[model samples]
Target: MLSPSPNSSKKAFSRVALVGKFHADGIEDHLKDLATLVSGLGCEVFIEAETATHLGLSGYPTKTAQDFAGSIDLVVVLGGDGTMLGIARQLAGSNVPLVGINMGRLGYMTDIPFQSVKDTLPKIIAGDFEADTRTLLDAVVLRDGKEINRALALNDVVVNRSGISGMVELAVQVNGSFMYNQRSDGLIVSTPTGSTAYALSAGGPILHPHVAGILLVPIAPHSLSNRPIVLPKHSVTVIEVVNGLEVIVNFDMQSQTNLQSGDKIEVRQSDKTIALLHPSNHSDYKTLREKLHWNEYPSTF
Candidate 1:
């Protein structure tokens, strides 16, 4: 769960779209069940094109992920965080809030559980939900001061070395000011929404979603003093590859682009954002305790 916005007048969602993790087991049956339920609520139900094709579902009208903007009132994603990340990026800045029904392990972003979606989704569809807006990272690859590649990431932008390569050397700068030069396996520039993800796994601190900051975490730094740091939300970070072979830059680990020496990766907070809708009862702290297993200890102690 994310920190929820204030409760507002519930807006009726008459048009709803469903996206599923087609690779997940039993997805077809789950989508069918949801379609029936949405229809029962007197709403028009649509299936995302790729999802429909994979499941061989043809009974419902199909739309591309891009087409869902301005067309659907709400989008329901039935998958894990990976699936949600993909759709969230596609729908970023669209103002079409997304609801996630978790069907994967360690669902940090996909907080809603499938077992409870039956009892929960109806309320959300009727506008009884909390909305949380998350910022996005816009990154571009620069070679000879020319833009070569660009992408938006809902999580962190990672600059890493290949499997067979040793530590890469990166020169870091913030807002055009020199920061540091370091040799490490990689570097992670993460948003608060991604603080709990790969950044955390790389020894980065877990920042609350509402926190206004960006995280920089080094992976296997050659110098022990090269630790993680948090930058102001408005700051722009630039990392130049001064050394290493097969270096690459990844946007949320979903997409990747090979990097060469002297190539600069420029990252900044995007003007756009993703809006996530949650059950009214959602609590960020409670979710952390549950998903991160903070509840494993004796509560009575």
Candidate 2:
């Protein structure tokens, strides 16, 4: 068990919104339990509109994502990292911090486990947590020099080929300077906070959250020499589709749009950021070791 900070006895967030993964089973019970506990702490609780609707929950106040922005002090998210990502992006620029209770696999950003929620949530609500501010990426899709679509991502922006399509030919540029032409399955532009996600699996290096950098990872390039590279946080990366069939650009894999052969994606760090609250005992290395099984030895001798 982790010990709380010395300030645990002091109240931190007086108003909190509970956001949960609507698709998960038995989520109502969890929300109810959380509401009971939170209200007992003398704090006002609001349920995210959709989650409340899905569970048909009554008695608790409900607020939409937009409504939560300036009204709430903190957001308590329950689910996997995907759920956290969605809410974080929705609530970006609000300056309201978020804490996650993990109910999914990998549980990277969703640090608190369900078994530990009771212990952790109270401590966090009482000002016993560490705060981390993470960067977001703003991406715009252009066709014929006209902006066709745009989105924001807390994890990564991926441009990839659709099913049965051949390798995508992409022309890359950094801050208006030509970089390379690559034939590959796809490309990933990840922020430091997302270094351990798709970028890591694509052979990109893990950048600590404090690093002010962006990562460009090639997804199985035709030429093995095309490796991942780190770019300055201010560098604007433009990826033009030289050729491909049914190419698609995804924003954190939550939203996507089809890309034309001449389409270009412009990606850059956004002015908005999301804050994550963790227990005082949280450690990035500890999370990596536990989540990636680094501390476990191989069973086969």
Candidate 3:
């Protein structure tokens, strides 16, 4: 496991922020219960402005992500990994630790279940929890030697065919060295944190969250020889559209942009890291076993 940050002991979560997915079933009740439970612990609680509006609950202070990051000591995300990913990107460099409550399917990152919130929140608020830091990816799109779009992703960055029905050609380069030129459906450049996400579906290896590496997985490559490769965390990967085919660049499945031929996409490790707080008993291997239904059957006589 990667060493915890030196400032982990300095975290005093007196001001907490609540972020949730809008229009999700049972979210309002969960939010209400979470707010009451948090306030009972003698901590000031704030809600994300949009979530607050959606729930139609007034009187509690609400703040945008940018404003909330500056004032809140901790952020409590009440949804699945997708919601956490959105907030993670927003609060990347804020240094505000995040605790996730699992309210959606496949809560790999959001380990805390709704039933355990009552028992878990107090321990976390008291600084009696485990802190795991995860790396993020910074992706930039360049066209004609000029920067066009940039975004951050907690999971993987994907470059795939957009509107066309056929495969596209993409030239790959790493650290100024040519890697490969292939015709495939797309490519996934994922961080260790994303190994179990979309990358896994593409046959990429599952890298532990603490691992300092990036995964390059080809999406349905036409060539049988094409395979996934793990690169150094600091390596800069460049992908250029070679066939003038229209392609889409997706960031953690959250944001996307269209790309034309000759456009270059660069992905690298970001300096910012996400501080994820988990219950003391939380285990990554256990999560994988349960979520992925691995080794569920015992040996039979």
lDDT ranking, high to low = 2, 1, 3
Instruction: Give the Å shift of residue 44 in candidate 1.
Output: 0.6
lDDT of 2 by residue, 1-301 (tens): 2233343446788998999998888788888888877777778999999888987999999999898877999999988899999999999999999998987465779998877877888888988899999999999999999999989999999999989989999999999999999999999999998889999999999999989999999999999999999999999999999999999999998999999898999999999999999999998887898988886545683
Off by over 4 Å in 2: 1-9, 104-106, 296-301
RMSD of each: 4.3, 3.6, 5.3
Residues 1-301, model 1: lDDT tens digits? 2111233124479889999997999888888888877777777899999899988998999999999878998999999999999999999999998998887464777889887776788788777889999999999999999999999999989999988988899999999999999999999999999999999999999999889999999998989999999999999999999999999999988999999999999999999999999999988887888878785546685
lDDT of 1 at 11: 40
TM-score of 2: 0.94
lDDT of 3 by residue, 63-149 (tens): 888886669999999998998999999999889999999885658888888877877777888788999999999999999999999
Kindly give the stretch of ten consecutive residues in candidate 1 with the minimal lDDT sum: 1-10
Give each model a TM-score.
0.94, 0.94, 0.93
The C-alpha local distance difference test score for the whole of candidate 2 amounts to 0.90
lDDT of each: 0.89, 0.90, 0.88
Model 2 residue pairs with clashes: none
TM-score, cand. 3 vs. native: 0.93
Instruction: Give per-residue lDDT, candidate 2, residue 234.
Output: 98
The deviation in Å at residue 18 for candidate 3 is 0.4
Identify the candidate with maximal lDDT: 2
**Candidate 2 residue 75 C-alpha distance from true site, Å:** 0.1
